[model samples]
Target chain A: MKTIKSLHARHHELSDTHHQLEVLNSEIFTRHYLPTFREKLKTSGLLPLKPTGIEVFQMNVGYMCNQTCKHCHVDAGPDRTEVMTKETMKQCLEVIINHTIKSVDITGGAPEMNPDFRWFIEELRKEYSGEIIVRCNLTIILANGKYLDLPDFYKKHNIRVVSSLPFYNADKTDRQRGEGVFAKSIEALKMLNKAGFGKQDTGLILDLVYNPSGAFLPAEQSLLEADFKRELKDHFDIEFNNLLSITNLPISRFLDYLIETDNYEDYMEELVLAYNPKAAEGVMCRNTISVDHAGNLYDCDFNQMLKLQIESKAGTHISEFDLESLNERNIVINQHCFGCTAGAGSGCQGTTT
Target chain B: MQKTYYDPADLKKFGDIAEYGQDLADKFFNWYNDVFKDGALSSREKCLIALAVSHAIQCPYCIDAYTSDSIKRGASEEQMMEAVHVAGAIRGGASLVHGVQMMNKAKKMLM
Candidate 1:
């Protein structure tokens, strides 16, 4: 008989191995621990999750990011080389144009890090008329000389920049992100402001994302937004259109933290205990389709990260999108679905309910 | 059917108090709601204060609730801990300050 050590046992520190973490996810989110997420939803009349519409097409360009945050579900970092090729981008563009997606969201380890990112966006601008969102980690804006003109580029294209800033101050923000990240993020925000990103009626919308730095659900969006607005303005003289409070999904680095710190079961229980049917109804997966760097499709970004492909007879790839069939297909879900349905509910656009 | 002084599960049933008696429970909830809202001090500040008091009173329920409340309300780990330290300082000083009475009484009798 042969035995393999659990990923948690094999390594003493956090590392990104999708399969390893996926195995852990399977083990941790089981019926023995609690009722299956689907069962919980069925009890509340929200089972058999299905798509509402494809209003947003979110594309994960790659797995390369500048900073490796502790709670990043994507496990994006500097070393990741899995980037979307020009061919895939072309296919994605075809889907966006043909489907006429109302909003096309681009994400990544850092979407901008993709070599074809600018080219793809430029090509996308040529045909797509809807809103384009870039999920940027602000540090990337100041990463190097090559990225210095990013704010200007976003402004030039009227891109709605949605960036993550864990907290308003250096201490908390830096602790969650990496060291000196707070300062650089501030400088980037100032640059975006200079480019008319966050100003009122500027038509250059800038949004900030806030996720809890530890094992907890985010506070009410409006109150936290007000606090962020006041603190950022008073201290850094920074400005943004709105703050989106997002729940940290239990996956990737966060899952490791929960398991290692002996908080996994408790955290899952909290999410299950706070299950909100209203939120489940408005889950982003219902309206958004996620496309990975490889051009494969999933119900949402969380599903995409977990390698859960959309199940359809036609196929789940950018080249073969049967919008009708996808609309009718059952949305694949697991315990991670709780992150989107818990409490006020979390989505790419912020609180669902 | 088991009975205990404290059940961790009961924390989730805190809102069920209104089920037993709606009138008084409603009043308590309304007052509690009003107290935590943004006033002269921000809600985050109120949470920090609540966190400190929760520690001083040493109520595990309050501590658990406010710890999550404070973090959710944007209180940093450092800020939250500092709030706890403030509670500790005040509590410690409270006992130490009473030492003056002991010193005065001893001086009057011995000196």
Candidate 2:
């Protein structure tokens, strides 16, 4: 059950140009949530949130994935044919090498599925000395013959692997991701452990990510990390370096879930009520730029998925790289930004606080 | 001019107890804050415990506060409901177990 295919089949995706997110145009989510969020920010003295600077360059390689998770904002899946061609990738590399970007986080339905994924990393390593992160969905390691050596590949390149494991147990994870995903994920983790990916002394980092199974904010990151560490270690002897707790933004399939369950208003209300200005100031958008498969730039991955390209005169495509103009650009925000500011706040790197 | 039981707004003004006796209220507030801080049990677990106890005591304000607090801290609706059930079972058991005492007294007196 690929995420994009399943979501499209279920929601009858409105337009291809909208990245299949046009179904989120319901007035209630847009009109109602925005006013409430604006009012809350007004109360918290955090009105008019603006970007700080970009340090991280997040690239979405494609929308092809092995698994279709329910809460996935990407709506990535196997049936999708979209992929980042070598030409666009070259443009991205040119921008990265010329700029002072600190991190390059590669993501996709499963970024490894891209034929040029390894070659691109190798190329980046040649020029960029900064951190390189791969947003992996663990099951991908066990998906096919080509991916069997992913752990070894990651080790050789010293790429940080950040994988998603919805829960410590199989039942919850399988229920969210797919039927057989949990067992495969565990097997993959054990492989990572064998490869020294999660070992303490090893610089090769392996971080697991957690997102709520339903419409709720994530629990405290530290506590959840402890629980995950204990359960995974005691049960399967799985070891990981860190756990990232991410808030589920109301976009893509998650937004569809909100609408389908009629929890859109209530969930938005919870986000607004839990607004913390400290979190807003540290939002990933303030320090990161998200570039989509077509080489278009955005303030964050969420903005990219929504097609909210950078509002600047230098042009939003990577071919027109203007670090000075991008640095001065104001971040584009909406009601959904409350997801990043709620509770401890959330971002690609986990809790902002 | 106005009389009502359990005003919803009273939950927000809970700190106003200091209005009557400033010293004791300050002590209570500090104690309350310390008790809820992260410790042997996380604030999240403590919120669940508080939610269960609120149901047992039938305190509307505690329920409202802890309901929002637990949700803000990431407790699911299902988990919250399960906690309330735990409280219900305890309260129900507390009443049911005393029947053993009633039976013992009845046998002793009648005989």
Model 1 per-residue lDDT tens digits across residues A235-302: 98889998998998888778877877887777887888889889988999988999999999999998
**B15-109 in candidate 1: lDDT tens per residue?**
99999999999999999999999999988899999999999999888888898888877677798999999999999999999999999999999
Off by over 4 Å in 2: A1-4, A9-50, B1-35, B54-89
True-vs-predicted CA distance for residue A302, candidate 1, Å: 0.8
Model 2 Cα lDDT, one tens digit per residue, A38-74: 6666676655555666789899999888988888888
List ranges where model 1 is wrong by over 4 Å.
A1-33, B1-46, B89-93, B96-111
**Candidate 2 TM-score on chain B:** 0.95
On DockQ, the leading prediction is 1
Number of the top-ranking candidate, with TM-score as the measure: 1
Q: What is the TM-score of chain A alone in each candidate?
A: 0.93, 0.93
